[model samples]
Target: MKKNILSALLVMAFGFANAQGTGSRFGIKAGVNFPNTSSDFHENENLIGYQVGIFSEIKTDERFGIQPELIYSTHKVENKFIKEGIAYNNDVKLSYLNLPILAKYFVTQGLSVQAGPQIGFLMKAEENGINITDHVKTIDLGLSFGLGYNFLQDCSVDLRYNLGLSNPIDFHVGDENYKIKNSLFSLVLGYKL
Candidate 1:
């Protein structure tokens, strides 16, 4: 994750060095996320979530742009298990402050491809009324890639995938080194101002 962030910074710095001029625009975006955890116990579960945010886009050219966003995202996981011939259900909810830096390449006037890295800070989590801060850390790192279509008026639809690079929680019973991987898929609506 550290390496990814460093790479993004280097890329952005290089872009800035070669940039002729800069144009700034602000926009609003909202999205739905389908979340899942990668672990032995919860591999079968799928969770639904969402995100809403504001972004600042700095254009470098007709074909390239950089967008930085601040987003509020909700994530979760649901598990169903059978105990003593009875079914039990459990849900875990997580909230995060997500920052993503995206590099975009426009394929046409209306379509573009984007890839980026996101850093998330965990804000809150609840698990059956037990405080689980010790089980989780506040920092999360993820990679995101997506495609978007923009209308002539600057409204757009986006589809993105966010894959976790680090575990947000330490779920192992006794091993501090053990962690669980999480991921999300989001469909977003965006508008430029």
Candidate 2:
């Protein structure tokens, strides 16, 4: 099953590679992320993260395009809570290989709006200095909304927000069950070659 999926992805990549000669651009991108987790049981610590990736933008017309990206990303959320007048902090750090396929609609020559579905494969998970990979789901589903601006000299910038659609936790804190969902905002700079 994995081999079949890999084969299909290779075919799609080859097709896109062929199309790149005609107005498509490929580039490298890196950025900072503000990662968050939503849970009523804890106070937000708001961890900062990082992402680096490759992207391909295929133009369909002067004002429309499709952009696909593969990114290595890190997400961390820390919570400090007071129970029985004692304060404790718990932090969860996660790593993922994220794929986002975006549809771009240009409002002007250099500016476009983008929206996409993002699939994330969990690479690692840790909570409070302990490995917690076995407790979290390996696949994360998300939606991304963002804006992009292309400049001269094959440079561009993107600002995006990713909202998680799945609850990633499989355990509880004391007696509290968590429905933790991911939220991230990112700003990336890209240069095409």
**lDDT string, candidate 2, 81-153, tens digits:** 7766778788899998788889999999899999999888777899998999888888888999999998986
RMSD (CA, Å), candidate 2 to true, equals 2.4
Estimate candidate 1's alpha-carbon lDDT, on a 0 to 1 scale: 0.75
lDDT (CA) per prediction: 0.75, 0.84
Candidate No. with top lDDT: 2
Instruction: List model 1 lDDT by residue over 47-144, tens digit each.
Output: 78889987766777899887777788987776565545656565677888787888989899878899999888776776655566555777889998
Model 1 bad stretches (over 4 Å): 1-21, 80-89, 129-131, 173-178
* lDDT, residue 176, candidate 2: 63
In each prediction, how many residue pairs overlap at the backbone (N, C-alpha, C within less than 3 A)? 0, 0
* Model 2: per-residue Cα lDDT at residue 51: 97
